[model samples]
Target: MNAPYLLPAMLALAVGTYALRWTGPAMRHRMRLSPRMIHLLDTGALILLAALVATTALPAGTDHLGLALPTGVAVGGVLAWRRVPLLIAILAAAATTALLRLLGVQ
Candidate 1:
């Protein structure tokens, strides 16, 4: 493997990721989004999050289901529905997942 190339590649990827993230707020400040645009952006973000979750939960060629995805989703849903604090929601999700794994549920 080209070890020397790895650092530069990783740095480039990181910088690109940062640029993409910053593009949103930078553009937002310069150009206010319309209500429709805002709604579209919100939906897009949710879709991206769902895709990320799905990818993590169900990796390619995996036959077994994992508890992490379902537990995270459940916790997130509960938090949203109950209007729970963000920190508590995160902790609850992490703890629940850990406990489930410890008990060998998945």
Candidate 2:
């Protein structure tokens, strides 16, 4: 929310996206993973994905959001786990958060 930080944040995000796009193909020729290694990599990716979500949902430091984020995340996670389409799951989560906030939930 800091105006002065926006450019730096956007630049960082762009760099991160660029890195993610480039890293796999860039290193692909350097190593070949075994099946077990592939599985572990997949699992590690999933864990990192979850960790990112958790951090966003339950933020630390100064600008504290609230429990509504995590509650909505749980709803979204259940829908996703039940094989709901990605868009629907995301909308459901957003709706949940909005409704909770409207109802004065912290």
Candidate 3:
């Protein structure tokens, strides 16, 4: 937290982050991932995404899970699955959540 060290530390982190971001595209051509590895990576990404959605839709450490958030998320998911426009789906989800909250659904 010292003033003198803060800038240098930030610069180091910035450079390191940029290098990591650059390395992926830089090495993509040379990296030969096996089919199984590629499949695992794809599956892992989906699992991670689902986990993120679940956590956000139903927050942790709450006394009880509320209906509004999960219902809104389900609405969004269904719309997305049905190939609805992303913006419309997101707005619909937000609207659903707000409406449910306003109606005292908690």
Candidate 4:
């Protein structure tokens, strides 16, 4: 938590994250992705994104579910159902989250 240590820690984290992201692309030429491998990678990415959303919106040791879960659900539903624009999907999720929070659903 020290100021000096913070920079090093952040740098390491960034590098590690970058490496993980680059792993698939880096191996693209060397490896062919089987259907199962492709599915697994896609699932892994979605799970990681869900975890990030949960952490940011729900946090830890909190009873409130907040706007994250519902927003993610809405966005997923829209993506699955229709060929909507990315911006529209994002806006819909944000709007839904705001409405849910305003209604005291958390």
| 77-97: candidate 2 lDDT, tens digit per residue | 777666789799899999998
Ranking by TM-score: 3, 1, 2, 4
Model 1, 19-96: lDDT tens digits are: 999998889768877999989988896676567555654567768778765776567546644668867877877777
Q: What is the lDDT of residue 36 in candidate 1?
A: 98
How many residue pairs clash in each candidate at the backbone level? 0, 0, 0, 0
| Highest-TM-score candidate | 3
Question: Of models 1 and 3, which has the larger TM-score?
Answer: 3
lDDT of 4 at 27: 90
Worst 10 residues of 1 by lDDT: 49-58
- Model 2: residues with Cα > 4 Å off, grouped in runs: 1-33, 62-65, 80-83
- CA-lDDT, candidates in order: 0.74, 0.84, 0.85, 0.70
- In model 2, the worst 10-residue window by lDDT is 48-57
> What would the TM-scores of all predictions be?
0.58, 0.55, 0.69, 0.49
* Residue 99, model 1: Cα distance from true site in angstroms: 3.7
Clashing pairs in 4: none
Tens-digit lDDT string for candidate 4 (3-97)? 99999999999999999999978898997779999899888967776675446545567776666556655574556346567577667777777
Model 1 regions lying over 4 Å from their true place? 48-72, 80-88, 100-106
Error in Å for residue 33 of model 1: 1.9
